[model samples]
Structure formats: C-alpha cells, structure tokens
Target chain A: MIPLLKRVAVILAAASFAGALVVAMLDLPAPTVHLPAAVEANMAASGVAHPVTAVLLNFRGYDTLLEVGVLLLALLGVLAVTGVRAAPRAVAPAEPAKRMLARLLAPLMMLVAVYLLWAGAIQPGGAFQAGAVLAAAAVLLHLTGILPGWGAPGPRLRVSLAAGFLIFLAVAGALLARGALLAYPPAQAGMLILLIEAGLMVSLGLILAGLFLLLSRDSGDEA
Target chain B: MSASLAFDLLLAAALLWSAWRALATPDIFRAVVLFIVFGLLLTLAWARLAAPDIALAEAAIGAGLTGALLLDAVGALGSRKDGAP
Candidate 1:
C-alpha cells in the first residue's frame, strides 16, 4: 500500500511538472520590450549586406575563430582523457526484420539531409540543420557496422572543418584590399549568400561528423 | 512583443529546463544525454532568433561536438561497478 501510494504521488508530480512547462511556454504573458528605433534604421542606412553573417565570420571573425579553437581543444582533451579504444561491436544478434528496415530507410535519410542542405537558401532549414542531420546519417552507418574505415583527423574531415574559416578570411582579405572590409557586391547579394551558406553547411557537417567519429575512436558511444 | 520574440522566450525556457534536468540527474549516462539534448535545443532556438551562424555553430560544435566530448568523459570515468550502485 505504501509503495502504491508512492507511485501515485510520483506520477502526479510528473504530470504537474509537465503541465507547468506547457503553461509557461504556450501562454507566456505579452512582453514589453523597448529599444532605440535608430539601431536597425542605422543598419539599413549603411547598406551592408547580411549584417548578421558579417558579424558572425568577419567583423566578429576573431571570436568565431577562437570558438573553433576552443572546440578543437575540447576534442583533443577527450582523446587525451580516453585512451584510444576501438568501439566495441554490438553484442546482440541483429534481427533480420530490423536490418531490412534499416537498409531501406538509410538512403532516404541521407537524401533528406542533402535536400535540406540544398533547400536552405530560402527556408527555415539551413546548413547547420542539414549538417547535423548528415552527421546523424554517419552515426547510423557507424552503428550499423556499414561504415567505411575512419582514421583519426582524416584528410576529408580536416579539409571540411578548416575550409569554412579559411574561405571566410580569404573573402574578407579581398574586401579589405578593396578598402571596405567584408564588403559584398550589392548586386550579387543572393549569389554570395548562397555561396557562404553552402560552404558553412559542408564545414559544419564535417566538423560534427569528425568530432563524433574521433571521440568514438576512444569511447565509441553514440545515441 | 512580436511572434518571433515570443518564440525565442519559449526556446530559452526549454533550454533552461533541459539544462536543469540534466544537472539534476544522478545517473551519469542519462545526464550526458540530456545535456546533449540541451545543446540541440539551443540550436533550434538560435535559428528562430535569426542567428543561423550561431545555429550552425551550436548544432555542430556545441551539441554534436560537445556531446561527444562529455560522453567520452563519462566513459572514461568508468561504468558502474558490478556490485556497487
């Protein structure tokens, strides 16, 4: 009877907590935010394209570069902490039914990831979302034991991770030489944005996949 | 004030809650998993906030990379013992 009461109490508490979360998020009170109107107006007056991305990789390039460095340091730290161990093979026998399902669905997942990366130009989806999804595909391959060989800090992974920063810097240097740092051709805004975004997607995908496989070299765990 | 701001607030709340729960968990593996979920949640929020650059960084570097690192850390800390809880 006591155990039964405890179980009921626990369930009620969980339900109440979930209810609170829903209320907090779905029925948030109207917010009163005040900001100077001229801030955005001033941005439009200057006429620089993609002030956000500019800030991300150019004006704030130093910060982004530093952040990437930090990520590298963390990866290195993980490798150091966990002496490299080949990921263990799954102990369980694969059910033929599940294996067939996995085989059929895998290609579709990869296609969806590619489509997300390509369609990011004009939608809510973008390089980051696409890259994360792509990394998930790589993880599936790894889990299913169908992955081709992976080496630590492989050439492809190295190139993908470094390319984004290098390309951004190169573009910035060209603009600097032109006497306006990180400037884009006003007429070719769409083309330029598309280019940068594509590069970002590839770099992001590589960085994510590399981090996973590299760390897995020692830990070999994935979700 | 706007629909976007409201959305950002909700995202922020979710991130906070995930982080809190991850920290509160006693089991190490589950905590690590929840933390990874927190990272992914932040990526979605960043996108809605019109920070695609941040969203990219968060999903790839923050969520994916950081999650890998911490999971490896837990694995290094050693799995629970045969007799001990």
Candidate 2:
C-alpha cells in the first residue's frame, strides 16, 4: 500500500514549489531598459554586431578569460583524480553503418561549426555555440571509432587544449599598449574578436572532447 | 488562449513530469533516458521563452553532452543480472 502521509507530503511540497514559481513569474517586474545604455552606446565599437559576443569577449573579457581558466582547472582536477593512465580496453569492431554515418556527418558538423563561429559577429551564434558544435562532432568521431584509440591525449591535443586561453591572454596583453587591458583599437576590433573566437572554438572543442574521452577511457570498469 | 500557449503549457507539464520520473525511477537506465528527454524538454522551454541562444546551449551542452556523459557513466556501472525485471 502507498504511504498516505508520504504521498501527501510530496503533493504539498510540489504544490508549494509550483505556486511559488508562478507567483514569482507573475510578480517579477520587467527591466526598464532592455540592453544597458552603455552596452547599446558602445555596441558598434565592440567590433561584432552581436551584443552578446561583444559583452562576453570585450565588455566583460576578464570573465570569459577566467572562465576558460576554470575549465582548464577542472580538467586538471579530473586528471589528478583519475591519475596518469587508463586501463586499456579490448578493441571492438565498428559497425559499418555507424562508420558511414560518422564519415558523412563529420564534415557537415564541422561546416556548421564554422558557420556558427563566423555568424557570431552578426547573429546569435558565438564562440561557445560554435565550440560546442565542434565538440559534438569530435564526440561523434570518438564514438564511431574514427579516432582509432582510447589512449591519453597526445602533446598536440594538450597544446590545443590550452590554445584558447593563451590566445585570449596574448590579445589582452597586446591591447595593453593601446589602452586598458583587452581594449582593441577601433579598426582592429573585429579582426581581433574573430581571431580570439577561432582559437577559443578550437580549444573549447578539444577540452570538451578530451573530457568525454577521459570518461569513456575506463568504461565498464567501475560501478 | 492561443494554441502556442496551450502547447507551451503542455510542454511545461511534460518537463515537470519527466523530471520527477527521472529522479524517482528505480531503473538506472530508464532514469538516464528520462533525464535526456527532460533536457530536450528544457531546450523547448528555452525556445518558448524567446531565448534562442539559451536554447542552442541547452540542446548542445545541457542535453547532448550531459546526456551522453550520464549514459556512458551508467554503462560503466555494469548491469546486475539478478536486478533485471
């Protein structure tokens, strides 16, 4: 038999939570300004027409820079906890259909990722979005056995993993000669933003893909 | 009053139900699958909220990557032969 008291408690808790959410949603006042005046005024100066990218990479560049550091730190932590080596697994034969799909879809996914990165200057796409797409493609490749190994990432992978952070720092440092940290010259802003994003996309993709690879390295070995 | 609103409400309900089931289900595999579905529902909710950027993020990072991770983790846990229904 169902526990009546427990059922009632769950119902009450759910109702209260839902009611509070609805009340909050209904009562929350809309912001008076859509985009802050500062953001609106200097949006064009940010190089990219997209406000979000501008804010992420320029207005609040320090935050993005630190966030990349945080991601790398997390990976470091994971590596520390997992140790230097993963137990080798028996190679499983790849299904032909999956192999064909991976070949067909990998290019398509890469193309989409490039498009997203390029579009970020004008549209909703940006470094994070493009990076995620590229990572997804990499994950697909790993899954379909196209990558050919479950071994620890090589030196090239390691360098590219840190590429985004390094490039961002270099850009910020270069701009110091002109003015404040990360402040690009007006004419060079667009080029700088694009350059930074391209590096960020590659690094973010590699980092995320490496994370998944680490997880799958010792598959079926633990509970 | 509009059909889209009705659809959104239905989607919200489904999201809530899926989330509850994902947490409460006894089967680990089923729970992981439900969690993935819940993530997709969240992607839809983000779209309905007029946040395409967030929707893309939810679809890619939240749903796709996290779901893949969870499923892989579950697979690594190994199956208990006697635990099967």
- Chain A TM-score values for every predicted structure, listed in order: 0.59, 0.84
TM-score of chain B of each: 0.81, 0.86
What DockQ does each candidate score versus the true complex, computed on alpha carbons? 0.20, 0.60
lDDT of 1 by residue, A1-223 (tens): 3599898998799889999998999998766763334334434422234455444443454565455556556656755664444433432334667666667766886677677655554444555566677666666565455553245455676677777656656666776798776655555544554565566666766666656666555443432
The segments of candidate 1 whose C-alpha lies over 4 angstroms from its true place after superposition are A1-106, A154-157, A220-223, B1-18, B33-76, B80-85
Tell me how far the alpha carbon of residue A47 in candidate 1 is from the true structure, in angstroms, after superposition: 11
Q: B3-73 in candidate 2: lDDT tens per residue?
A: 99899989989998999999999888999999999999999999888777778878999999988889887
Task: Tell me the deviation in Å of residue B13 in model 1.
Answer: 7.9
Candidate 2, DockQ score (0 to 1): 0.60
Name the 10 consecutive residues with the lowest summed lDDT in model 1 chain A: A39-48
The runs of at least 3 residues in candidate 2 whose Cα sits more than 4 Å from the true structure, single-residue gaps closed, are A1-18, A30-33, A36-38, A86-91, B79-85
Full-model lDDT for every candidate: 0.63, 0.85
lDDT score, candidate 2, position A50: 82
